[model samples]
Target: MIQVAAAIIEDEQGRILIARRKPGKSQAGMWEFPGGKIEQGELADDCLRRELMEEMEIEIDPYAFFGVNDHHYGATHIRLIAYRARYVSGTITLTDHDEYRWITARELTAFTFAPADVKFVEMLHSSKPRLNE
Candidate 1:
């Protein structure tokens, strides 16, 4: 199993960040929350912070677990830990993705998302963050 971490990064205006997968890559052109595979022995939040910096050149305050998703595709199954994060600072750079957008919840369905991310986006649109934890 491959472990990964994704951020549901929200801006002050309540818009969520989404990125387009670069062409010729696996799941090319699909929109996804920025993140990458977790390296061995690293905690999930550490992975999220590293991936955001590497992929988008941004810093994040990792807070609140959003949800987890498990999905199988072809030969490998992926386990994704999703988190709610607030963007701290960075210049937007596309190291892995082709494009980025700040979109409202209602706009999520407009993009073609990776199967795992699609579920999370749907949940984001349908529910409020539970704060009693």
Candidate 2:
């Protein structure tokens, strides 16, 4: 199974950030949380931090475990580990995505997300606020 780590980065207003997968990348054109595969031997939290920095040039402090999901996309299967995180610093400068948006949980359904992320989106919409402001 592919080990992945993703963040539910909430802003002061409680909106979460989502990124549009860039063309030429896996799941291109789909909107999803910012994260990447966790390398072997790397902690999920560390992987999340590294991915955020690499993909958006931002820093975050992940807190409170959110949830996990197992998904299969054709021949690729993934186990996504998600966490609730607070933005710490750095302006988001996307390098791997075509666009980015900050939307409230209720607005998640408005965008087309990668299939592997559909459950995460549902969780966010269904659950009470899990992260502290």
Q: TM-score: which candidate is best?
A: 2
Give the RMSD in angstroms, all C-alphas superposed, for model 2: 2.2
lDDT tens per residue, model 1, 68-124: 999999889999999999989998899789999998887788989999898898998
Worst-scoring 10-residue span by lDDT in model 1: 124-133
Overall lDDT per candidate, in order of appearance: 0.89, 0.91
Candidate 2 per-residue C-alpha lDDT over 10-125 given as tens digits, one digit per residue, 9 for 90 to 100: 98888899999999998899999889999989988899899999989999988978889999988888999999899999999999999999898988999999988899999888
lDDT of 1: 0.89
What's model 2's TM-score?
0.94
